[model samples]
Target: MAALSGLAVTGGTIAACTGKAKPQVQGKLLGPSFKAGHLLRKGINVVPTETEEQEVVIVGGGASGLAAARWLKKHSDKNILLLELENETGGNSAAGKNEQTAYPWGAHYLPLPNNSFTELLDFLQETNVITGYDAKGLPIYNEYYLCFDPEERLYINNYWQEGLVPRWGVPENDLQQIERFQQLTEELKQAKGIDGKYAFDIPVDHSSADAQYRDLDQLTMLEWLQQHELTSEYLHWYVDYACRDDFGSALAHTSAWAGIHYFASRKAEASNSEPHRILTWPEGNNWLVQRLRESCTDRIRTNAMVYRVGEQDGKVAVDYMDLRTQKYKRILAEQCIMATPQFVNQRLLSALPELLSTRNLQSFEYVPWLVANLTLKDVPHGKGLSLCWDNVIYGSKSLGYVYANHQQVALFPEKKTITFYHALADEAPAAARGKAYGSSYEDWKAVVLQELEKAHPGIQEQVEQLDVWVWGHGMIYPKPGFIWSEDRQQAGAPYQNKLYFAHTDLSGISVFEEAFYRGITAARQLLNTERA
Candidate 1:
């Protein structure tokens, strides 16, 4: 998920919408085929019914996998095959469309790239996100992709505010605290380490290793905030919200380094828009996912569930099932890129247990999430400022929703799609994940309705369809001491020059840029080894 920069504000009293009893909305409770993955829990014994060969095999078709395939296609001519478990290549970036409009199931936006990340900028340019560069060398973003006006608003104190950083009706003291926090973020944004590198880098791995900044990884974000004596209730809420928004972890659970990186790592400037503005589509990041898939589409095999990967003789062996045919396949390749997450890799690489240590894998933690897309019969009515791309309800456990069609030129349409996101960050991961996976559709419908009622009053009746998606292992969380730990480094290393690893989890934070970088890094490793 793309995380916006930090915010600050004033505390206030508010009232809740009391009228809605869960309206019987029509829709399906949809999720990943958990059965496909659960097969690994117990042993899946199968003999290969067919054999195949490839110069390189890329496993797991998420962002990292797709990117790895894209890079390999660009830099090398090895016969490559990309296997995806789902029918589509996008993982968290997957999207769906109904009669009303296109909508995202998970990650929805891409913040403008830092100028230093040339590769990311290049990809954006290739996809027409960065249409061109101005004489000053700043990127001129495509107007159509830039988040439209009325970018975001927050429902607070029973009133809607124009911006997310709550300033309306705030006391002078609260405003002072908010201003101080803003100043701190600005200073940190430019701060560099003694090693002549930014203290926080977007890909995260490129950050300076200077102890001055690395030491911050030892403490939680909340601890860091307390140490700096920046404890306004509003500031804390906003900080916590930002943490959960990006990291899927609470302020107390997120590493200070990771939290600070959230605000400081982005320094992207645009010729056509503000640096803070982000790019989005009706289908969210899925638009970019499709862009990445264009060149490598022919090489991708969907519904391929790879169960095992290991070194055999002098090559890599990958065993997978073609869900479409219910047949098994074994592919041998000169090199393999396991672009899957460590959680899945734990089982896939079990045949070669020596490749990973239990401790190293345990250091990686992921959080669960619940995303719902509701098609409303009419535009939602709310107090204050008009509807925007992103809307949040103050004090709600949910992260709120995004108007999927906000960018449409048509106004006040008969129907509109809005995607809601709720990170299970309020409790222990185990309990939250259990509830997410175990809860029935009715249970979640009630939850979704309750959160929406906070801002929309008795508007549940307007909901035509409410489809829910559960990301049980949504994304990696950057815990205290994990981001800069040696374990993280070890987990991402190449194995025997035959298998390479890539995933945002290896970076201790899940982001599009990180996933893209890891894929590029893994491909580069393989290409470099081939040359050697």
Candidate 2:
């Protein structure tokens, strides 16, 4: 165990007198002196105590964890505890602030919500994103935080253009295909099963399980596109980009069901806002995380790395190491929520006495991501529209980046910063993670700078600092038949009434909406169990 290193005091240090020389010590001293053998005590832990237990134990404090915590607290009277491996609660939704602007390390944006997503809209309303409902019950979104003008720009053929869809210099045949594809999506949006469930829905579980649609999940997006005669290169490129941006995989690897669902799932409308307008902040999803943390901070323990979970005396026992203390501790709860990704859950469940076979879990593949936040004096201007919410360079493997300061209407004259986001979707996650782990800070910086130099010449001179964040298992890809497989469904299902699963991976499409809804579903299920 690591030795504790500081003294605890209720007030300040006291003053000592020697030969008319005064040494002042202030405040009320509570504990022992610190000179080497002292045990460090902080917060509410100054008094040593035994292990604690709660009714519900939630692991992983990222967006999903925090969301689960919030929902559980709101709906239950039972004692609850949330354990986070990291010191902070946001997880991948974490954000940082430089001297210039606040930037996101991972997820940076959320598209507009469909009207059917009442729960998410309610949360937004509580957060003031939706100020009020109009006379006709239409939600009025906050004007300030709605994504600013010039939403997206693409650089192709050395010319900066507007919008992400390939329009500039697009061939006539490709344009027609793009239109046809949009028409097909519109048709799917209205599709329903014999059970009356939408063919595609927000919380994917709510979708129609009709074999006609479910069978689509068995095929790759590439195959479906080819079968539909959507063979335009421009159309194919746009589809690929959409899949990579949201699912973190290419069309060839994504499921036909997930790919089509991405387009058809959105059925949003607002009185004051456009259906396509999204609510975003300078810190991205971290903004939502702050709200989620408000109701559960007292119940959360950070930097607690859980290693094992199993049944003990008819209760769920969680064994975790306190990173700060370097000591292992155990907590027993009635139920557990495994809010981590499938990969991490596999390791934890492996230690259980009656471990479920992991054959199905192993099929899910996660992709890695590299996000670079650059502090710059100024961004070089391009030929067309100025910096937008989502910017990209056509044909570039990178997702380009967003101007972190774009949402901040209060403009500064000089010394601006921009976050350059590059998702290395081409490399397998295992290879990417290995390479990213071995890369030095300088090496990662070079990779980001080189990519930026393509769009902005002499950008190196303007850049004051560059920070790189690598996500080893950023998101689970819908990989070909994986989405529609029996394995995925089984992996996501609750096990033995003791363990529950929740993550974006269960939806077969990793996105903010899916992650949010996943947490809600798990929490609701747990609540229902307790009620019964």
Candidate 3:
């Protein structure tokens, strides 16, 4: 990424889903810096005309990069610089704003954290997410941050249901199966392994190392359900939705351990909220990114892409370009953190593949995703429930939409905006990405209208503006054998005691907590090595 290499440019604007005299929908197709990413394949031959030195340098301005910078500044007096390819730094946790409200571009919400993750809890407290602790030592979360009432609703049985679990029109047998499955997951949430560790943990690495659980990583989530005889169509649909929602893969494609972790990994509790309660804002996790950024804004450099990272003169040499000015610069750091994805890392560190000798870069599989934020005059009420924070269609291709203003304290809004999500997981990653990149506004607008038209018959006419963002490689999913694989561990290991790696992919799951920890992990490693 040279200058604004991956800035979300308006691909095009069109009169969307309109005919005759209908007030035409407006907005442009904006997406990740896939163009800049594409340029990486062409190769780099850079001789920097400018050079600088830093005690530590961070490459990539995503959650991990920002977090690492935030932590390093708190603990070290060393010079540090964070290079980001895009005009903005949040990465998937990024956000945007319109007159109506703020909405998420990628990751939207963070569930209640496991209380035992004290570092995360501390960050939350520092950010005012956790107000204080209760008498029992449980966190007293800010009530405003906890999702307001009517938290989730499912459009099923031609009506809206109170919660996501299938109940309304499901057959009695299916309902029984759903209840049984819930019980099983709840049990798994508490179940530990022979090694005396929780069967599933949020970060995945801290989970039980016992082979019984590790073997589960080898099977597809579908295989696990089949073995358990939980064959209810509704149950499978719910499970698949969870897999796609969190892991961005289908039931058969997602590893069983990862799928189970979707349900079992969440054990967060708060005195003011229910177990697994979520904390959200109008801007989604971008609010968290803002909090993380607050501690280290001065250290971040936007529109700066590190094209090459190698060792030079006993230090890590990072060659980057300022996309805005077409100027090249180099930063020689005593230590560095590579927070970019392996897809990019494989190219930047190509000269020293030995640094990643133990890792199979090709083994990592990232899925493409579509997020559309539509500002509408109003959302039509389905049969049973009104607009809720999180909404989903029972058996739809899209993940439904979230009312972006759901967390707002405003009793009545002049307009409503909903952020819709879709994972292109019906096909292989290559095919899905091809479709997403090739599709235009007309192609995408039709898909959004089709999904929404069923629930709200005339939603197309209510549209004021429609903005689309495409994630070419949304998040790394845990495929069969990928999570527990040796490569995952090796991928995160330090190189030459001078370079360290930090990214959600290294953990094989792209939750906010994981990314936050990935940053801290790398920062601590760098700090500990320096102490040595």
Candidate 4:
């Protein structure tokens, strides 16, 4: 196989190898291949047959799988099958709609893309989100998608304040510490390792492996902050909010490397706005997912839960159960891309030949989240900052909420809707999920209303309808050593140059950038094999 050297593969002559259709073989017995057969025998029934062929079978129809499918279709003429467990393709980026407006269920926001994120930028351009470039060659993002004015407000000391960082009624010393921290992060953004990799980069894999920087992965963010004498309660709260907002983990639970990366990894230079600006739609990331879905709608199969995967007779076979039909179907493919999370993939590939032990794969943990969308007659305004795109409360366990109607600049008269997103920061995700699931709709509504009532008393009266969603395993939490661990690195590597893994889990931190990069990486690997 030819070595894959570039980010994009434009065109290729790849074709599926033709073969006669084989009858469905059902049994628990191992196939001809001893290793693969033995591995299948240990797992649940429904192993792959040796005599079947498919061009490619992609598991999970999330951003990663969709990205891979887009790349495969654009680059080569190969038969590809994309399987998704849900009825939708967006995964956590899924959206919900009411009579008033559409809202996000899980992931609701995305930061602006850095210039180094060429693939992402190109995709945005293709989608018309990047309308054109300025004279200086920076991207001028679409005005409609760029987050509107009055971006964020935080409720603190019984007053709503402008911006996320605590500025109102804060001690001068703590303010100085916050300034120092931002300045240091700015320096780190420009810093480069001896190996020429950025000290901090999106997708994280692009970061420099230099020991000077990699050593940071060994310590917790809390430890690093304390070591730097940044012990102010306000400063700590802000940092913890940022961590939970993106990584779904608190400062003490996150790695110093991941924490600093959140601040320094952003190097986005745009023609219209500063590097810190972000692009968002009313429905959040669902807008981007719609663009991805446009690439290969015909090939995607939703509600197709993949159960088993294995290689047999130099080909890969994926056995899946159709949730709607309750029928089992097997897809024979030359290659397979597992874009599901590590935990789900572990179940599917448990039957695969020479697969890793389950114990090793179980080391990773995911955090849960509760997102509530409320239709309101009006949002009670406080004295200081007005309702904005992001509304947060200072010193609160919850990450406040976002107003979905904010992007619809055209003002409405009677009613407005706001989605309150709560990241369960303190408790274990499993416990939180259990609590959330056991609770009724009214109970969940009470939970959300109570949290809101803390900041806005009697605000529940303005609410017309409240809907709640619980993501049991919302995102992978980057514990101290997870990102730089050898185990995670090995798990992400392709198996036998045919089975590739792509997911936010592989990146050890779940973000849109990581999911996009994961898909591109897996697609590039498969393209290389075809070229070879």
Candidate 5:
């Protein structure tokens, strides 16, 4: 069996290390309302006690679903209903709060947006994230929301480095390779194709169709690096880290286009702080989700598990289970937007799989993730560097942890929370997801501590509370040939002009911006159909 990264251990070694159990920690496991959705898999046969008619029904209250609801409410007075299986609306963007502070469950930050995204900027402006515009027409971001100084650091070579990219103790040759790769990415960032479109653009669908650059989509990021003779181990580690951080996949599994896109896609104009600095809060994206939820509060319904979606009597029928009532409910709508991931969509529309070809659904593969929020009385100070907002341990399978209170304005605090993230990119998606779902909190705690102890010896003693959340289908990985495939292009197609699909999966990259875009696009399509 292949040894895990950083640990350099076979499967047997892992068992040996974790065989001895320690004192139980003082926290519980929390996650999405999987039970509500899992009930559908057993086959829901309950008859609906109530039938309602809606102008539009949006399934899945993630970013896409919320965005669709907001757009529809703003454009038309038509009654719209948005349903979410989880108790909370913000899918992966969900957050939890304790007395000390609020921490993220999944997604944690949003980079500065390009001015081209007028709609997104408008939403930000409405939410007070973009306070005003400067003399140069640059967006003025609120200082409170911008990430604090001492933003990122990396633990490398038994010492904490100042930045995420390895600079300390790296050999001259490896350093040069890393610099050369940066130069290449910088050039690509400014590169434009013959059609006057960026070689790599966010929302990926807007990227240049010029085959000269689009052809790269057919190759793995690792293959692309090898072809460029940029094979430094340090560089490989850095690139793989970026892939895992953004797409939750390694270089070998990620598409070259998506890999390059991660670095070059952002072309945000110079802002009040920095050109492309990220904006984040203690609650992560849930802060944004709250603003979106406020726009259409009456239209949103949580704890509603959608089981089947089919067309009947010239309208789409959305059958869902009301978890509170333990009974089925039905919504007949003129138009429907499925904001759920393709995996869930496949099952919901299983009876109508021909509409969304099963072959297209097979093309998408989701990566699993483990996020743990450790409440600590005080974190053990590492050797050379203090706690930064984002701290990454070099060569570890787990991406270290983020200081959740890094953005807090309070001058003094006795307690703190650190959110740790790990992407199981080395294993097959299905196998990793199954193993993660089957494991208990103790099993995960062992895995997390084993990785953290490498950077912080005896750190577990400082932990007061450790809450773990597993994302069975965290996000889609843009594997080679999958990004530009015909199936992906057809995945977003509306069925009979009555059913529209909107989800980050349709964009081939899972990001807040992509999900928002898909939702708004689907909503606009519905409006246009109504007008026609």
Candidate 6:
């Protein structure tokens, strides 16, 4: 396990499903149908039969796009049209429902927000997550929405511990090393640079630009740990696990700045909740996305794929294929906010290549992820911590699973669903994505079962159904030097202040807060330009 630390798996083939399993167990594979979106790559030559003029057009329906639409709706009465390629507007934060409960496809929780994110707090208040402000001026969060007790647990050394950190059966020296690392992170959490700003901030762009801190981006997290002379097998596993959990990369693959930011960047404050406390729902972040969706529902168009983005008559013109009508549609707007991934932008904005000068598009490598939602007859009871909201298996390649219905207000659940997560970090992005796309439902089912069986022996018998979803381009990998690179910085720049970019990828971290920040920020930028 120690030897595998800081190493990636890179493009290993999934073994064919051969063994026999319980006859009651059945499963299916699900994900975004790439056929419509990929057709854009081949260049769509659809002529617009209809044209719609809007003051602002937002492309993509993810968190960023939704946030942009919501902000624009509240700030301006501009004619806005938001388009989404998928059947739904939630993007990766999409969810599904069964007779039992609701479950998430991607993001699941929002950490107690940083106090500086006043807009986010306001959003929370609108959603009732933040009920009101206290006498101390701290926000009062809804207790029901907060994660319940036994928040997390880890299966390590043949036992389940209280938390994800490997504490049980660890040697004294290793325990001390873990403590030291924790103390360092705690210190760095409040540590500010000479610029009078937090060394690491949640939005990432807001972090200090001090040379002392920015230099960390040049080296790998492993190198940084070694420089500090902190070498414990347990610590390595913890750090490597954290890097993979958040950035979808190993210590060696993750930038030192990104790795540390994972620990120090979040300092959420509230009157009743601690910094570690987070807000979640049965359907994960889809709850938040739904709130954003409601704010600008009339402007959002699903089953609409934007294929061409061009400048016409000193305005941004978007050409899209309407999946419902099977007709080409065009939207000419005074301003545009592109909330799609950088890769999609590369092709969509091919007409204006010079506008996107970020030449190292290859540097924006993404990691493929496998998520399995299993419906079980009953929750599996392991030796340690019964099933917590978030569960982990120490030294395992997978990030373990989470109880999809953990936030249920019901007294007890006889049957439940678990959402399993795995980042294919061992292989290169391209090769891994190819392999993931080529793999079969049986292949993924076999892989998921193999990992889960480690912690829950004979658990397959209890699984009534399993659904697998593969994210070909799951999340951005902040490899060493990529986070602070010039290409990344330029990638976020607004083109002529007419077209803007917004996505969690711009921050190199795929989290709800960053995506929200990118969306609201882009919308505000467009508003400022209109005023200017």
Clash count for candidate 6 is: 6
Model 4 spans > 4 angstroms off: 1-53
Report the candidate with higher TM-score, 4 versus 5: 5
Better of 2 and 5 by TM-score: 5
Error of 4 at 395 (Å): 1.0
Measured with C-alpha atoms, the lDDT of residue 523 in candidate 5 is 93
lDDT of 2 by residue, 155-264 (tens): 87677788888888888988999999999989999999988999998878788989899889878888998999999988888888888788777778778898998889
Return whichever of 2 and 4 wins on lDDT: 4
The per-residue C-alpha lDDT of model 2 at residue 512 equals: 78
- lDDT per residue as tens, model 5, 43-92: 77665778889988999899988998899889898788899898879989
Measured against the true structure, the TM-scores of the candidates, in listed sequence, are 0.95, 0.88, 0.95, 0.89, 0.95, 0.95
Q: What is residue 233's positional error in candidate 6, in angstroms? A: 1.8
Which pairs clash (backbone N, Cα, C closer than 3 Å) in model 3?
2-323, 3-323, 3-324, 6-33
RMSD of every candidate to native, in Å, equals: 4.5, 12.4, 4.3, 13.8, 2.6, 3.2
- Residue-level lDDT of model 6, residues 1-532, one tens digit each, is 1112122222121222324535455878999867885797688877687987888899999999999999999998888889999989887788887788999888888899889988899999999999999998999999999999879999998888998788999999999988988898889888888999999997888898888998999999999889988899889989989998887788777899999999999988789988788888889999999999998888789999899999888989899988998889888899999999988888888889788554556568899888899999876687877889999988888889989879997757778999998887877778777778877777677677777877887777788999999988889989888878888888888889889888889988888999999999899999899899
Relative to the unseen true structure, what is the C-alpha lDDT of residue 41 in candidate 5, on a scale of 0 to 100? 66
Worst 10 residues of 5 by lDDT: 1-10
Tens-place lDDT per residue, model 1, 192-305, is: 899899988888978988898999999999999889888887877788888989988888889999999999999998888889999999999888888889979999999999
Model 6 residue pairs with clashes: 8-426, 9-426, 9-427, 10-426, 10-427, 11-427
lDDT of 3 by residue, 1-532 (tens): 1101111223232223333344667878988776677667787788898988988888988889888988888888878888899998898998999997999999999899998899899999999989999899999998899999889999887999999988898899998888888899999999999999999987778899989888999999999999999999999999999998998888989999899999998888788888867989999999998888888888889988678888788888899888899898988898899998888888999868687676778778899888999999889877998889999998875789999989887878999999999887777787777767887876676677677776787776789998888898998968999999988888889987888999999989988999999999999999998889
Lowest lDDT block of 10, candidate 6: 1-10
Instruction: Report every candidate's CA lDDT.
Output: 0.85, 0.74, 0.86, 0.78, 0.85, 0.85
Off by over 4 Å in 3: 1-22
What is the Å distance of residue 452 in model 2 from its true position?
A: 2.0
